[model samples]
Target: MPKTAIVPPGTGKPLAPYVPGILADGILYVSGTLPLDAEAQVVHHGDAAAQTRHVLETIKGVVETAGGTLDDITFNHIFLKDWADYAAINGVYAEYFPGEKPARYCIQCGLVKPEALVEIASVAHLGTATGA
Candidate 1:
C-alpha cells in the first residue's frame, strides 16, 4: 500500500522534518501534536487543559484529513511537561474522547517547547484503505 502524508491546511508546521500524520495500510499514524498555531508557535502557555484541547484538535484535523474520526483512534501516546497537570489534561481529553476511550499512556517529560504543556500522538484505524 502506498503511504500518504497528512497535512491539513492551517496546521502548524513543526520545526522537525515530519508531517502531522501519515496514512498507510488503512491506518493513520498521527505525529506528536503540540499546542501550536498555524505558525508553529506554542499556544495556551501554562494551561494544561487548554493545551490538551489544542493538541487533540490538531490530531483530530490530521485524522479527519486522512479520512477518519476521533472514534477511529485505537491508541495514543501522551506527553506532559509536568505530572501536576495530569488531571487537567485528562479533563479536556475526556471531552474529545467521551465513551470507550482509546488505549493511552502519558508520561511526564520535557516537551519540544518549554511553553507546551501537552503533546499527543495517535493511531487511528479507518478499517479500509482510502485513496489518500
Candidate 2:
C-alpha cells in the first residue's frame, strides 16, 4: 500500500517537524493535536471543554481528509494537563462519540503548549478511496 501524508487545509503550520496525519493501507494515523486554531495559536486558554472540543475537531478534519469520518476511528490517545479537568473533558467527548465509542486512553501529561489543556491522537480506518 502507498503511504500518503494527509494534511488538511486550514490547520495552519505545524509547530513540530511532523505531518498532521498519514495514511497507509486503510489506516489513518493522526498526530497529537493540540487546541490550536487555524493560525496554530492556542485556543480556549484554561477551558478544558472547549479545548478538548477543538482538539477533537482538528483530528476529525484530518480523518475526513483521509476519506473517513469520526466513526472510523478505532482508537484514541488523549493527554490532559490536569487530572482535575477530566470530567469537563469527558463532557465534551460524549458529545462527539455518543454511542459505541472508540477505544481510548486518557492520561495527565505536560503538553508542549502551556495553555493547552488537552491533546489527542487518533487511528482511523478509512479503507480504500473510491478508486485507489
Candidate 3:
C-alpha cells in the first residue's frame, strides 16, 4: 500500500521518528499530538483544558492537510496525565466535534514530554474525491 506523509505548514520538525500523519489507502493515521509550541516545549503548563484545545487544533491541521475534516474522523485515542482533568478536557473537546461523535478511548498515562498534560491521536477517512 502506498502512503504519504501529511505535514502542514508551521509543523516544525518533530523530535521523534514519525511524521505528524500518514495517509494510506484513503485513511489518515495521525500520530499522537502534544500541546507544544513552536520550540516544541509543552504549552498551557498545568492547564489540561487549554492543552487539550491545542492538541485538537494540531490534529485539525493534520486532518485538513490529508484532505479530511474533523467530522471525517472515525476514532480517537486520548491520553491524559490525570483523570481529574477528564471533564475539563471533554468540555473543550466537544466544541471541536459538535456533531456525530467518533469512536474513542481516553486513559491516564505518562506522555513523551513530562510537561504535556494531554495527547491525542486520530483516524480519519477521506474517501477518494469525485471529479469536480
Candidate 3 accuracy as TM-score: 0.95
Candidate 2 stretches with Cα past 4 Å from truth are 130-132
Clashing pairs in 3: none
lDDT of each: 0.88, 0.88, 0.90
RMSD of each: 1.1, 1.7, 2.3
TM for every model, in the order presented, reads 0.95, 0.94, 0.95
Q: Arrange candidates by lDDT, highest first: which order?
A: 3, 2, 1
Summarize candidate 3's per-residue lDDT along 14-116 as a digit string, tens digits.
Answer: 9789989988888888999999987889989999999999999999988888888899899999999999999999999999999999999999999989998
Q: How accurate locally is residue 54 in candidate 1, as Cα lDDT from 0 to 100?
A: 83
Per-candidate clash tally:
0, 0, 0
RMSD in angstroms between candidate 2 and the native structure over all alpha carbons:
1.7
Kindly give the stretch of ten consecutive residues in candidate 2 with the minimal lDDT sum.
123-132
Predicted candidate 1 versus true structure: per-residue lDDT over 13-113, tens digit per residue: 57899998888889889998889988889888788998898888888888888888899999999999889999999999999999899999999999888
Candidate topping lDDT: 3
- Per-residue lDDT of candidate 2, residues 1-132 (tens digit): 668888887668899899999888788899999999777889998899999998888888898888888999999999999999999999999998988899999999899999999999999987884211
Give per-residue lDDT, candidate 1, residue 47.
89
